[model samples]
Target: MNDEVTRYIDGAAPWQTAVCEKLRLMVHETVPEVEEQLQYGKPHFLQNGDHAAVIAVARNKVSFMVFNATEIPVVKGFVRALGKGDRKCVDIAEGQEVDYAALADILRKTTIAP
Candidate 1:
């Protein structure tokens, strides 16, 4: 993990930490080349010269925030997790189960696009 991401995760609550760790690892697995950084005090995953995505710990959920969620399929499946998003974010509760393979597929399809 990058120092920025480590710092961001360290600042979160225990549940947030767990969720963030899972998201972080999932993002890395899906896009190993995306640079991890701290943006707006949250962990951001960026593809070179492309729009970046952010993940943050919310009061009741962890959000995987994407710039264009309508363009991604996973956001639709996560109807329960979906919230009012300026871009489009997949907010997942700590206790809720996440489909890792599916999440990876969404991330891959969304982030790799030009």
Candidate 2:
């Protein structure tokens, strides 16, 4: 785990902090060798030096993004496509539940080769 990324999560709102931690754990579990960093003021997870996922926190919600996930199926909590449709994001607000297992499956299957 990267200290900068940890600080980013620690600085978020309570609810956002929880969501960020969960998302971080999911990425780490899915990709044991994943690298973490703080990029663009958000926490970014990389696999084999390529971006695998990112976690961002805003005022009202936390956003989890999967990279190279254009083929990933749309599921509950997925709010939008990003990065020229090569990425997808799930937004979670306070009290909302996120399918971490599903997101982990997507990460396991996604090829972060770019």
Candidate 3:
């Protein structure tokens, strides 16, 4: 990770930390080949020469933005189940638990696809 990426994660708001960390770990574990980088002022996972996803700290919730949401339909329901926008974000509140297994599955699919 570069300085910008470090700063991005380090400077996240309180509510974003847990979700960012979990998503980051999930990406690293499932898509070891994808590079971790900071782009558009957010921590992103890149694969196949494109960004697979971005994790950001938001005012109301922590969000994981899938680069191509429509390509991965499984995430729609997953995100909805998390009380966030389906096919867009899997938001969780502070101190809230997330479905890590589902997250890992989403990351895996996001990275392996075209």
Q: Judged by lDDT, which candidate is best?
A: 2
Would you estimate the TM-scores of all the predictions? 0.79, 0.90, 0.76
Reference-based lDDT, residue 18, model 3: 57
TM-score of 1: 0.79
Candidate 3 lDDT, tens digit per residue, 19-111? Answer: 677688788777777788777777877887787777878777777766555555544444642224234567777777788887777766656
lDDT of 2 by residue, 41-106 (tens): 888888888898889898898888888877876765474777787888888889987889977887
Task: Specify the poorest-scoring 10-residue window by lDDT in model 2.
Answer: 105-114
> lDDT values of the candidates?
0.73, 0.84, 0.69
For residue 51, give model 2's deviation from the true position in Å: 0.4
Write down the lDDT that model 2 would get.
0.84
Worst 10 residues of 3 by lDDT: 77-86
Model 2 backbone overlap count: 0
Q: What is the lDDT of residue 46 in candidate 1?
A: 83
